[model samples]
Target chain A: MSWLTRAGAAAAVKRNRRAPLLILLLAAVFALAVPRPAPDHVPFGEQQNVETANPLLCVHTLLENEVQEAKIKRSLVLARELGATTIVQFFPWAYHEPSKGRFNWERADRILGHANRQGLQVIARLGLVPAWARPSGPDQPSTLNYLPAESFEDFARYAAAFARRYAEAVKALIIWNEPNLSFEWGYRQVDPAAYARLLRVSYEQVKAANPDMQVLAGALAPTLERRGSAAGLNELEYLSAMYRQGAGDVFDALAIHTYGFRDPPAAEPNRERLNFRRAELLREVMIAHGDGDKPAFITEFGWNDHPRWTSAVRPSQRSAYTIRAYDYAKSNWDWLESLCLWALRYPADLLSYPDNFTLVSADFSKKPIYFALQDYSRQRARSEALWLPPPLDG
Target chain B: MAAAAAGWLKRPIALGLAMLALGAIVAAALVAIIRHAAPPDVRTAFPAGEIVVGVDGSFPPFALDDGETLQGLDIDLARAIARDIDLPARFLNIGYYALHDALISGRVDLLISALRVDPARMDDLRYTASYFDNGFVLITDADDSDANFDALKEARIAYEYASSAESQIRDWEEDGRQLMRRPYELPQYALDALRLEQADAAIVDATTFRLYQSAHMDWSAKSEFISHDPYAIALRIDRVDAWKLVDSALAALKESGELAKIIDRWL
Candidate 1:
């Protein structure tokens, strides 16, 4: 329709060959300047369900920090491959809602989409205070975790939005993580009553949005700090305090954080000791509170194997204890719904002891623990040794 | 004076040279003024007159509590930094995860916990220039011909099974560099395999390699980093004065070779 437009451009280019080069240069610059999405992860394209003999096997995934879609998909794919039927992923309020009323669900949508395609059930763990919700002043230097009481309603609003948006893909919503620790409570005095109030508010809001979505309370951290300690109150005391504050009615299930530390899976737990079986002490507290019928989920549990870290076990023992812990939970804890590991993998290595908690490395290399758990989940017998006995023969 | 000035101004060459010289002098003066004007009030930067340092004292060769007191490279570095800042230093043995909290809460002035400089924490914190690299490295025997990466074309590489070294090997393979991988249960085992000449090369983090070498001082090996995980100090972003002073102290340490001596004393 416009022959002169194209003809004139061709005639001008012929007149000045540098024009074509200049045009190409401009094109290259434009291409480079335009922001590009991380190479879009091609989904599995077919519906896939996790094939597992133990549905209690779950892993908390730190995918909120992942910047690439391909890595997110790969992590979820690995979780599915490991026979994990459920994953506990954080949906930070700060990340989703940077402003008071605004919301950004781009990353959450991608994660849920991939999880759905992989047939993985996601339990969204929500926390972290946005800038608008956090108190700011010259003297008050607050962290992202410094959630004020006034912002509890704002966080509930965010949790409600998240539940409503991904109700189909997500199975449950865990409100807050490790609130028993003072550090998780923004360096303030640990308050169990305050946490229960936040939970109650969030629970009502989330249920109103998606009644089918189960709300879990108190992914309380396991600590030894007593009632007067500045660091934190122990989870047992904190849970009791929550129950007294009427937290038992607000949440449908309980979320607990326990670790094996240096203890074996069968190690007996005591009031003064911490181990894998410390979860039982938490359950007993629930029973005393007359909430024993409510199901519990161990949202964060694992053993660290860092060589220099004081509380860590050996790599072999970490693997053995993890599998044993899963088995023990499946056989003994009928009230427990899921026993999730502390982490699946970090988006990047922290280059510290905490890195030992992951089943996969930052680069996606499956650890021996991953293999061991895969074997346990798939019910495959390990006939061969993991490695050569040693170089002792030399 | 007027006659002399007029005479000098009449000579175009002399006039041009004089103006250029004046301009250079003015520029140098301005640079000196800017650099020296903001001598941070140490009283305001560190009101306690002591640098309270937060460190996870569990990591040996960096910082470890020997049931009496914390000592190691990080501890020494913190003491040296406080000395350079003209303040007495107090140390708090803290958990690794709580290091940042202690700093931000004003409970501690700074953190030197062998922490990798994470970009995500930059929003609320500022990190000093790297003091050490603890990344994965390819270690080969001193006498081995494959000390250089050239032999990786046909090398049987040993590394801790499922560790960062193993992941680095996988990354190399994905980049079209084929490697014969031998994964041991631990990095020490991989180092042992290399020392025994069972493998052409072994890969492990620099910290592990150093600790192993320290245990076997007679064993000679050469290592080069395949990836970089730099450890640095962190301060709250709002503490501009403290950040500036600490950064300069680190630079001074590097310049005087004191930093290298401190690193060598442990690593």
Candidate 2:
């Protein structure tokens, strides 16, 4: 070979040997220069399954936007300590699937994992469509609850994935929240058939994903609006219409939102007055539809005591009425599964009348209702134990 | 290379140019560091040259709309505060429930409604000193010799049935004070009982008493606040400078007796 050619080949061999070392030095410098995120600390260990004494006591936990893991764990622990076996938590589809097909399960997993560890059975309410799922039609405003007709399958797919992912922890799933209210129905005219279709699609998908999951439908808000009103349809008429659309066969259990606005639980139910016993009217509608075999769940029911709100009761009345309502449910309502109170706590101040309905403050301070219910649950447990038949002699 | 650099530095023109470049770089870096290290300006919490105040016009005496114009004690007090701060005051009539949201969402710079200072909202809102007390007070006829509760131990006291005043009277009875408690259907009726000689004294809220006294000048309020629920102005907690300015203005008004004049004008 020529001398120049030989020299070039030797130089190339030397450069190739130094290339990896140079790249390694550069990688080390880059690693030292950039900041790395702190390692994630799993807040909870494996949850111990402990059954609660009061099966009738349930609370709606406002953990949908609670970002802190420690706070989430503490809220669930308090609920379990209050003898609540079931907690109706909102697992919004928009939160989990922010993008079309991509799913971020970090927040959901943290909440579900803590709830499971606290031995709280979750009734996951699924709704709240993502912005991407909302249609870009000129007539529809980009709102939180605006889910167009085409996005039903997309929502169902999210529900199926959520059910399948947390089937072991969450056995009950509420399809939608207060569909009878115009605010919840994307501000469109309240259509029972449309909600029924949404429920049917979700029920089929969830059941297909996890056959053991109990699908709850019809979280109708109690309104006194008559037919053809712009606000909403009366919850009873809406449920009746839902039945007419063959919604009874789709859902495993019926979900009802029965609020005791200013009346006591024993106040007789009327077509015009909204009260706690209004759930009875809903249950009667279910029975008349021949779906009496299915259990009805009070998904949202409570009284607010905000002094300025016209519909609020006194604080003392709220405590007394809440206990009385629970007792009445236990003694009278045989067809009911659980009476989940409207809310346990909020992550922040809602600055509205709904703030007065919470059992605990946003900072996790237990309110009077929390202690009153805890005392009532303990007493009921003792009473039930006393009534238990003596153990048979082996 | 070392000899060449020394030769280049030996020339006065080149050395001056190099030193100038170095000084420029240093000055640029110093400016950048100072800009980065300075604390962010916080006066941007509210819009400039305007002080927006939210008032619930439904509350009478404190803030109410009189057909064509909004007139109340709170309205005048807010205007005075605006004058003191040298800013134009724009009042937004918000509902009582939406008052907190409006302030927090920056829809209004502050609130002058008859909002009680809620401890739960302290984290989100910064409250100035109470402008008025809307709690229950003992009221008697203008000529009653035993005007205060302490002096009227054996006298009959009337309160609205199932009202907070009744509860307070009961609590006092439990504390070993023998009070002849009389009940009326409404607070106005309870005050009317005192006027009509049906009862020696009547316990009613300050708002009710103010409205009643404004209508019938024969009744008079006595005693220190029985149930202390003071109405205060609220602003977003982040508006430190604005809150300081408004709070100082309120303090000056209170010091100058202008607040008392405003309260007396409406009450």
Candidate 3:
């Protein structure tokens, strides 16, 4: 217990007290010196310029849940190889904005970037409400497409954010798809006026964000139900109701889904039957409303070749009818902008009639219809060049 | 004196470090024991003597509801499997798309609604050996000499349009062989064409061919299987004991001739 022992203990205490501080300082220096690895660069910020002979040629691509970037790139590449200059891709709001006021554009950016890189114009459909945006009444179930009327402004903000972000790359945006169907309209009674109001709000917000962006409305599902029916209103009757509710002024163009269930494209258009020419009935509604000058975009249309589906046609018939539908639209419907088919491919097997609508299989194998469409597009391109007059000498 | 003081100070610090290391070692050992411990046996998750089976009741001849009771080949086969495994069968009608979800969510112990073995979903579920082959087969009037694709050259072959059979026929055509392909909207019509002497033979799936043969019983099928699509029972991958039981039951059914009798009842 002498003074020597006491001094040695005191010095040891001092050294030990400095150890933690010294270690922390060295760690901080190391951390600051070593830089973090950069994330893989995603190409963006470029304008998409697509050129093709057939302006009416387009296809819907399922890229929202496509996990692989290579698959997304391949889908767009194959579409372009098939002479399709435009594609209709779904950009679900719930997927992009999972929570309130927060946005994750990682997947959206990859899809849009790859699509733009492949020289394809994307007609982006925006819908699907996040859980937080849905209504919370005792009777209200949280559904993907259910958005309370109070959350319309929040939805508009999302649309505005999207339009502002992709303003350079994408020039067209569709607002809320297939509202005429009860299943699509949150399983509530189909209301054309409410949808028109939704479209008007979205159109104003999108235009404010990007004036150049074309706002598309009325991607209505084709049904034969009459007024007061529970399933849905007839698409023609729904369009008339939309015009009655002043939807004609809010949208730049009308977007219609023209699926020819079992009939060919040349099948006569009747209010009772669903056919490719049913698009004619939709156009007639626009003309009646004096909005005929605005072009119509057939955003979803095709024939399914499912062997078991009652509505499906034969595989060969599907291929033949699809090409004839394109030719019919080009020769007969001058007011049409594009005839994008139902789908190009899905990420996995839907195991239903819906899977049969795809031009390419889930495994990336091209179907016979895909080859048929490609050949048709090539021949049409050649015919178009032949029809073009020689450039006048300067 | 300084050295003695340092020694006294080091003793407590060293003691504290040792205690911390000991605590970490004890914590890691406890964690390992808990993690590697055997989980509760899923085989006994159901009722004491019953196995819950999920079936898509809409697929007729495989699984169907006659508005009161579920009856079909899949139902009888499931019953037979349950009997072999010494468990009572409780069938839960589920949609085709929700079958996998029902199995994974523990709503059902087994799925036997003519489930096809999907390689994509193999990681999530284990499948028993195939009990039925719904593959494409070549059928004739029991008097034809052409027994295979190579022999079917220059022969009129009838197939359902837009069907897997048509795709196979087209593949043969692509391989430099010519087939007088007559397409029908329904497989029954194709077989009818073959029976009516309009076609030399018919290429159709085994299911359609069996159903047609059940009614006619005069048509004979060639032994060559053109395509392979077998139906097997699907169980959750984590149910190790349950999978073993089902696999053994399927094998026993195959060995005892009960599987053939059950299939014959429907076919």
Cα lDDT tens digits, model 2, A1-394, are 3655877988978888999998999999999999987655456766755445468888999798876777888888889888898899998888899899999998888888888888888899998889899864323334466677889999999999998999898979998888886657765678999988998998899889999999999888887878897657899999999999999889998888888888998999998899999899998998999998889889889998764455678665787899899889989999999999989988875533467789887766566577778877676522321111212223
Give the lDDT of residue B254 in candidate 1: 98
- Per-residue lDDT tens digits of candidate 2, residues B1-267? 999988886898787999999999999999889855653233453456788999877656677776578878889999999998777889887656456656654567899987778887798889999988888888876666657767768778887654567768878888888888777545677777777677788898787787787897655545346887778889878777677778888999999999989988988
Chain B TM, per prediction? 0.85, 0.79, 0.82
TM-score on alpha carbons, each prediction: 0.86, 0.60, 0.63
Candidate 3: Cα lDDT at A386:
10
lDDT tens digits, residue span B85-197, model 1: 99999998877777787788778889999999989899889999999999888899898764677667868788877777776777789989978888788788888888887
Residue A160 in candidate 3 has what lDDT?
93
Q: In candidate 2, how many Å is residue A276 off?
A: 0.5
Chain B global fold similarity (TM-score) for predicted model 2 against the true chain B: 0.79
Instruction: State the RMSD for candidate 2.
Output: 14.4
Give per-residue CA lDDT, model 3, range A1-394, as digits (tens).
Answer: 2655777988878878998998999999998999977665544434545455677789999999887677788788889888898999999998989999899998888998899888888899999888788874324434566777888898999999999999987869999988887657765679998998899999899999999999999899887879997557988999999999988889999899989989988999998898899999899889998998999899999998865555778777888899899889989999989899989998875544467899887777677688778878777532321111211223
Question: Which runs of model 1 end up more than 4 angstroms from their true locations?
Answer: A1-44, A383-386, B1-39, B66-68, B144-146, B171-179, B255-257
Structure candidate 3, residue pairs in collision: A4-B1, A4-B2, A5-B1, A8-B2, A8-B5, A8-B6, A9-B5, A9-B6
Better of 1 and 2 by TM-score: 1
Q: Pick by DockQ: which candidate is best?
A: 1
